[model samples]
Target: MSAFDPVLSADTVDQILHLYATRGDDHYGEDVSQREHAEQCAYHARIDGADDALIIAALLHDIGHLLHKFGEDAADRGIDTRHERIGSGWLARCLPPSVSEPIALHVAAKRYLATINPSYLKGLSAASLQSFLLQGGLMDAEEMTAFLAHPAHQAALDLRRYDELGKIVGADMPAFDSYAPMIRALIMKDAR
Candidate 1:
């Protein structure tokens, strides 16, 4: 996918929102709805000073879950139908690497975190744990070694952090509007 193709336009965001609004009711686990989760991710990314692409990535990361119709069983089956891969591919058609790569890497980040932080693994659901192994098992020592060689490691790490914190359930969750300007600024800057 060309970097320019994946750049989120107003229509793209609208399509995403509509997709979530219609399907958000079918959530599998956790009290937070999909829309709520996206908002939380975007909010946290902004708070962490993430670039616009990263913020958009956070907001749209899990959209695959809604888009692909995967259930907890499929997610747990270690099936290649993992939402990250699916979502990243879909996003790649419309957005740039700045957005798509992190979404693509977020699942790997989950595995990476699971390997390094025992506590992180402990917090995962049984399905998530199984899927983690199927997805790559902390990416293997060799893969991890190679992954760490990249400059984007820190950005991927930060995206992972936002991914985790974004799942909280509560009325107190931050709003998405607050981060819209930042997202716009980032996209505009990238366009330049």
Candidate 2:
């Protein structure tokens, strides 16, 4: 049961920014860049009163997609190389449970959404939809029941919420600065 650590350093959110800079090559769906998604997730997490660690997790949970080179069609390949698993595994080595758990569980969030919310499933991209089934669509009733019962369930759910709303077309999204406070707070919280 190893814990997760963030690859980004507190001295600078450069890693995230770098990821954003390459959004053109990376982003999977909705035409929203990676940077845009991070900011949006952080913004919504703050508004929803998530704790500092949770906020940072919201901003960075998808980072695994970038770091692992999972590509945009990860869900479509039917390969089980889930970005969440990769990202969560990487984070566990550097970050604390507060940050890593949500990231690790975000994939489960996708499954949960597909199962419980019709509207949620409708919003998924084609690749995301296919990957969803590939990941674990065949879970038996017992497995589904057990998955939702995990401790990180709520965190995964919230992260998913932010992930969905993070997509924006042109403008009207929160600035990156807004996330600074939350990131700082999370770092501090993890340190303490």
Candidate 3:
């Protein structure tokens, strides 16, 4: 398939799974592959008792990185791929706002946390820190205020935390296919 064919064609659960199975091995500068990071994030969300949508949001948050033409080291090259927007935009077509909005806002959530909690920046992984800088570093006062006003801001923050918790080099994680049932159910419900 072409570079973006998978992303452009993936509007259903099966296709989305295929996208991951095909492209998830690229680690995107992190210690874990995209699939591993996604599984770990979902695991963290579930352990924290997040709702279904939030869990799915956590699992798929960085999907845009796979969908883009930019190589995995876009951040290293000082280009912000804006994976949040691309991933969220794609998911919005199949899921409700409950999932997509948080994915969209998660980067902003990171920026917000960095601005409000100095210690938060210290916990970020090297790849995250690089992307964080490319993603506009810290939020200013007005940006923080605006971010706070978004209805899904809290969930976004939660997803951001999970995102950071993922990326363990060799953590045991469930297979990516395990989420297929939940994703299929969500797609079916949203189609109704």
Candidate 4:
């Protein structure tokens, strides 16, 4: 009921999902709702044969945005929101590194992709492209070199790729309840 209720639990996941269901409708310039984007990203991950943890990472990557007090379109206010850090910090407690690491690096993955792949940059949706600007723009050569060497680089890049592809509007996809079991399995015992 509260914004990110300071606790990691099954109920927290439910509250997060409920936030997505209730408040995820505004994607700014995009066609899909925030929840739709999440589900489609997860769907793309499954279709691409990603393992369960990676799939879960794809599904919940933008949760920071949902958890923000400013809501999904917070970037509109010139605030960075830093959803990746916000989401990933809470997530690190609830999930294993396999899931949280890539999430923490996702925006870095975006910046990295933009610098290394011109076509990928060109292919971004207007909203993503705009956020890309607010997201710190393209990585510089030094930053790119460092990012490429990070351990989670590949996984984050994969997450970025699935993220790009997940923007399909009106896509038929599974609901969050379908993912409850896997998410619960992945949650740490202390958290649950």
- List per-prediction Cα lDDT, in the order shown: 0.71, 0.71, 0.87, 0.80
Across 1-192, the per-residue lDDT of candidate 1 in tens digits comes to 335433355556566656766775555345677778788888898889887888888987887887775573565455656787778787666566788778877887787788888999998865457667777676679877866776666677888888778777674755555555554455455556
- Evaluate residue 93 in candidate 1 and report its C-alpha lDDT on the 0 to 100 scale: 60
| Runs with alpha carbons beyond 4 Å of true place in candidate 3 | 1-11
Tens digit of per-residue lDDT, candidate 3, span 1-192: 112233333456776798899999987577789999999999999999999999999999989988998898777788998999999998887677888999999999999999889899887778878888999999989999999999999999999989988878899998889998888676666656
The worst-scoring run of ten residues by lDDT in candidate 4 lies at 1-10
lDDT of 1 at 88: 79
Estimate, for each residue in 1-192, the C-alpha lDDT of model 2 and write its tens digit: 233234444533554555556662466556777667777888888899997777888878877777766566655555666778777776555456778888988878788777777777887876567767777854467767877888877888888888777776664767665666665555555555
Which parts of model 2 are misplaced by more than 4 Å?
Answer: 1-14, 22-25, 73-80, 177-181
Q: Look at candidate 4 and give me any clashing residue pairs.
A: none
- Per-candidate TM-score against the hidden true structure: 0.79, 0.78, 0.92, 0.87
User: RMSD to native for every prediction?
Assistant: 3.2, 3.5, 4.5, 4.0
Backbone steric clashes in candidate 2, count: 8
Q: Higher lDDT: candidate 2 or 3?
A: 3
Candidate 1 ranges with C-alpha deviation above 4 Å = 1-10, 76-80, 125-127, 174-192
Top-TM-score structure, candidate number: 3
Q: lDDT value for candidate 1?
A: 0.71
Q: What is the lDDT of residue 26 in candidate 4?
A: 56
